[model samples]
Every structure is written in C-alpha cells, then in structure tokens.
Target: MFNMILRVTENPVRRTTARDIAIIAVFAAITAALGLLPAIYLPVSPVPITAQTFGVILAGAVVGGRRAGASQLLFLALVALGLPLLAGGRGGIGVFVSPTVGFLIAFPTVAGLIGWATERVGAPYRLLPGLVVNTAFGIGVMYLFGWVGMMATTHLAPWAAIVALAPFLIGDALKVVIATLTAKGVHASYPGLLRSRTARAVAGAA
Candidate 1:
C-alpha cells in the first residue's frame, strides 16, 4: 500500500511536485511585489502606471501558460483577500468595483496569451517576434480592457476614454520593449526558459 501511494504521489506525468507549486508561489509573490512599486496616476484616467506589467510579462515568459496563469490568479486572489498588493498599495474588495478592475481581472488571460505566443517562437529566442507578440497581445489587450472599463465606469464617451487612456500608450510600449529584452536575455542565458514539461515528455519519448 505504501509503495502504491508513493507511486501515485510521485507520478511526474500526472501531478505537479511540491517544487513546482513552490516555484509558482514565488512567481506570484514576485508579481505582488512588482505591484508595490510606485505608481504615477493620471488625472484623467483611473489607471495608474506601475511596474506590474513588467512582472506580468516576466511571469508568463518564465512560467509558461498554465503556471503563469496560476501565478497571476494567485496574485489576484491575494488582492481580493484584502492584501495591499495592488498598485499604490491599494487592495481589498473595493478595487473590484473600481474603474481599473477589468484590467485587473484580465491579468491572467494576458499572461497566458503572452506565454502561448512566446512559446510559438521556438528555439534560440528570436527577439523581434517575441517583442512584437508581447507588445501587440500583452500590452495592447490590457489597454483595450482598461479603456472599456474606464468608459463603462465613468460613463465617458468613447473619445473621452481614448483621450484619457492615451497618456499610457507610450509608457506601456516602453514597458513591452523592456519585458521583451528581458525575456530574450533570460532565454539566451537559460535555454530551457520556455520549455513546457509536456514538450519534454514528447521529446523524451522520441
């Protein structure tokens, strides 16, 4: 019975080891820490510029889709639980109803999508394609959600929403560039950065 239990527990193909859970937790903590960075608030927009995007991109690039999404979910859970883990050290149930809430809720999806796109770039980690994917999908999608949320919450016209969100575009684009370069450097230094366990399993079989 003990042997059978060990086999069940240690079945690498069927389960994540404690190490994986711990690593995911660490990434979640990293995401939370990034949110603690100083925020620059725009007078016209409820969204504040923060380093959280950098963490979001890095988490996805390093952890792949499922784990990256898990990490983001964990971070959001912390915020939902009333931890001051959001930008400007703000958190709690109140944030859920705030204008920026849609963007907050979309974090996991954005990370997962970014991870999926980055994985398709294959080996050697070509910089440009990954950069473009991260920019177009990661930051762009986030802004879309945020803009809609702002309009909905503020009852602003589309043009007003666009004007309010415009200030963030250039800064966010710079963040995407930074995240892309960072991901490229990590991939070059650690060639296994983007490899999923499923890929490893298939490769080992072949």
Candidate 2:
C-alpha cells in the first residue's frame, strides 16, 4: 500500500507535447517582455526593480516545475547568446559574470521550487496560502541567491549585502501578490492548468 501510494504521489512524468512546448516558449517570451519594461535603478546597487520576477512566479504556478525551469533555462540561453533580453538591454556571456548572476542562476531553481510548492498546496490554490508559500520559498530563495551574487561581485561583507537588498524587497513583495493573483485566476477559470502530460501518462498507466 505504501509503495502504491508513493507512485501516485510522485512527480508526474510529462511528455513534451507541441502544445506544451509552445506554452513554455510563450512564458519565456513573456518574461523577456517584462524585462523590457522600465526598471528603476537604485543608487545602492546595479540591480533594478522590474517585473521579470512576476513572470518567473507565474511560470511556476501555471507551467509546473520541469517546464518552468526549462523556460528560464531557455531565457538564460538566449541572453548568453547575446540577445539583450535582460533589463537595461544587457546580455551576453559577460553578463553572467555580473552581480546579478547569482539571482540569474537561481532563476530555474526558483521557478522549479515554486512550481513544486504550488502542486503540494493542491486545488483552489488559495491566494493567501500561495502568497505565504511564494514569500517563504520563491522570493526568499531568490533573494538569498541575489545577495550572495552581490557580495561576490561588489566585495561587500555578508552583512552589508543583506542591508543593500532591503530597498528592493517592497517592490518584490508586490510582485509576489500579483503573481499569486494571476495564477489563482487562471487556475479558477481553467481546471487542470497544472496537469502535466506526465500526470496524464501516470493516469493512463494506472
């Protein structure tokens, strides 16, 4: 009984259908577009407050883990190949060495982690609970990566890095709220929004 239950609870094995690929690509583009929106650069750091993280959060709740991670990977790949997809029109391999690289590195993991959390939270995907989860894991994890990157690049002490990041938290908090609402709204209107092809296959197998 325990073994059987484990199979049912496992991450669904997703087959990458054409439609799935398209949806993933669309989210990647949406993230890139958000980066194109105006960024408010703060005096304290090179990183700016932008809407890209909103896209990241949405990808998690809407696309599920593996695909959401894939989308961010694709975005990063495009940027590395010298498309100015990042905010401020910055890109290229060199950008990977920038202070934001830590946060950039966390992109795939952050999306994947949030996706994992959303699935665990189950149906109806309540906003307050989702907000709590996103705050704890999604935003928290990214900031951890972000400040580490800042510390390395700027040669700041760990304590100073944390202090430097304070200004951006408020805007990021708003993004957490927006992301939760967007995902919840989609989930309400379209059941099985998080249903993976893997989940379908598992059902078929069962």
- lDDT by candidate, in order shown: 0.79, 0.82
Model 1 clash count equals: 0
What TM-score, computed on C-alpha atoms, does each candidate reach? 0.79, 0.80
**CA deviation > 4 Å runs, candidate 1:** 1-15, 39-48, 196-206
Name every residue pair that clashes in candidate 1.
Answer: none
What's the lDDT of the predicted structure labeled candidate 2? 0.82
The alpha-carbon lDDT assigned to residue 185 of candidate 2 equals: 92
Candidate 2: stretches off by over 4 Å: 1-14, 40-48, 195-206
lDDT top scorer: 2
- Backbone clash total for model 2 is 2
Provide the lowest-lDDT 10-residue window in model 2.
Answer: 193-202
Error of 1 at 17 (Å): 3.8
Rate residue 134 of model 1 by lDDT: 84
Candidate 1 on 1-206: residue-level lDDT in tens? 85785577545545666667776788889988988878876665565678787888887776677778878888889888999987678889888888777688778888888877777666556678878878876788888888888888889998998887787776687778888888878877877766545665578679
Which pairs clash (backbone N, Cα, C closer than 3 Å) in model 2?
13-198, 14-198
